[model samples]
Target: MSLDLDYLKLKIELFLLRKKAKKTFPEDLSNLTLWSQSTGLKVAVIDNDGFNLKTNLESIGVSVTVFYDYFKPVSQRQEKRKPYPFSQYDIILCDINDVASGNDGFGELQGVGAIEALRYNFPFKMIIAYTGNPAALSRRIKKEKSSNLVDKIYDKQWAPEDFMETFKESSKSFSNPEARWQFIRNRLTYLDAKEKEIDKIREAFVYSCLLKGNPKFLLRADAELENLTQSTLKFLQQGSMSDALRSGLSGLGLISDVFGIVAAIKGT
Candidate 1:
């Protein structure tokens, strides 16, 4: 499907709003699990240090299986100790820091190898690479075409809280895909318009600050300019910025003056 700017804008706005609202975390996964009955979510966690995660997953009512380094080997002894049949779970949560200990150790199994194994062994399941090494995980995902294997990649620092937030948002959005799409479209449109207005405000502010010739004002204006540039770049990277805006306003049937204004601000 084509990218919908309005939809993208809405998603971002809602995300920001949610952050501001500070939604309470469900005591456990009780509400989430009940919600999942209609959604049919079966979660599994794999971590060398799984004690806390295991408890949290269980509290949410997900049937969780933990796989530590010592337990990863396929040796007869390790095979005997495998907790849950690999085929039992719908989702797998793997830790990147896990290191096998026995003669049949799986080594570090950090980057692409572990993801490959999970995909090769269980074609039906989804894997969430929960790691402390987010930079490495991101790099691996970028280099490989294993997006199909990984449903999500989360760093350990943000796993519990961020994952929960993402799950809740996805669950809510997926409930009615059509409505969600429309909502997103509208939001993107609003964001595009808002961005233009903000750009104009920024240009005027910069001119005033520079004209006043106040060092303190100039410094503040410079900081504001940096922030605006960064924000614009972020939207462009995410494909949330409007094509019309990127192509220049004249092409989008906007007043050429708006384009000139934006360009002037950018130049400064």
Candidate 2:
């Protein structure tokens, strides 16, 4: 509910902003579908408060592995156990301030330092930074955006409901490539049939446009899709660049046509 409020507020704000300015790209390019498929999802948490979160996630059927800090060398720490292989996780929730101290492997890695180390070591993994300090977290998020290191940033104090809701939505979308493509196809097929949620339909249309080489839409669809669509489109575009992911999206079906999707959105 709390997470939904933010999205509701965003929709309302976008609707108002659209009236004043020519439709342009949105500042926030968040793709809710990246974690769309969460069945049997693998998650790793690297935070001081990860135990509670890990327990909660596990109750909901999520496979979660918690680690305090990987920056420390095995020789320094008494727990000489095998660490959770970061490569196997679908999502990683990390705290920027959860750092390592003296005589550590990574040399006192803290905050952005820890985040960067994880990003470098696990480039393909989805990393999210969670911290109490919004300002510091935002800075870390921005720094990683160029490299797609961090998929999202949440406040460490996020309400239980909000965080869970967000996690569920993301996980549902995190399905395999074929499922993702099927989802896109289903949304496309219903674009014209769904009359009430025109806003949602337009959003899907905009996201689906990323498959095409160029975007072309009529006046109505163009007006319906403004910043929100642009932002989602950009994120998906970046995500689709990986060879495995691209093949997954394109292998099953020739990426959906942009013009057709635009027309469907316009009901033309």
Candidate 3:
């Protein structure tokens, strides 16, 4: 996994990883028809990247949410920030440096660390590295072990044609239901570290609540938005969420009745 490997090794590793992905991924292309007619992909843009690619990306159909200074939500740089719901995003584009004001081991390149965390915890989602500094990628990817996880890298100065091509390749996973499941499950592992009585939360939300909708999967999504930090939602300023993804989690019953059931489970 060392970044110092020769070009041959790099190509070999990349090939193997990509091959493994193609072979092991769970798929159900039946919903693909739903995608083309929908609002395109759900994109989370870390560090904003100005408006350069935003309008262009939207033109092709993706709904983008810019978490302007994700890592440094507060004035204090010591605090580690929380990511939004995994099921909420389809693709994540992150910059490697100058992401607001903070450092959680990645120093000025905190976005790389943030991207690494997202990739490790949610492996199935499409993650693209978008940055003005390629040198920062060399410096940060090595330390973060994120070289292979990123699907593609788009320089901030990339030509319109180049970015359009990148989008074409990256959006292929939009039709993947299995990949979406992995994204949700892995996020639970990360959330478990901070939330208490997670199993209870899942049961109350999914079986009782979510079962109302996607009964096939007993995974419940929380009804109480209180469990999520204000910053997580606040940062999603212009989040253009799609109805297709009202929630990877869906449920029935009164929000009061369903949410009241899990209200006491502290730290969720």
Q: Candidate 2's residue-wise lDDT over 234-262, tens digit each? A: 45445424443333233111222221232
Provide the global lDDT of candidate 3 against the true structure.
0.49
Between which residue pairs do clashes occur in model 3?
206-220
Highest TM-score model number: 3
Candidates ranked by TM-score: 3, 2, 1
Residue 52, model 2: lDDT of 72
The whole-model lDDT of each prediction reads 0.45, 0.50, 0.49
In model 3, where do residues sit more than 4 Å from their true spots?
1-34, 75-87, 135-146, 176-268
What TM-score would every model get versus the actual structure? 0.42, 0.46, 0.48
lDDT, model 3, position 28: 29
The residue ranges of model 2 lying beyond 4 angstroms of the native Cα positions read 1-36, 76-84, 103-109, 140-147, 176-268
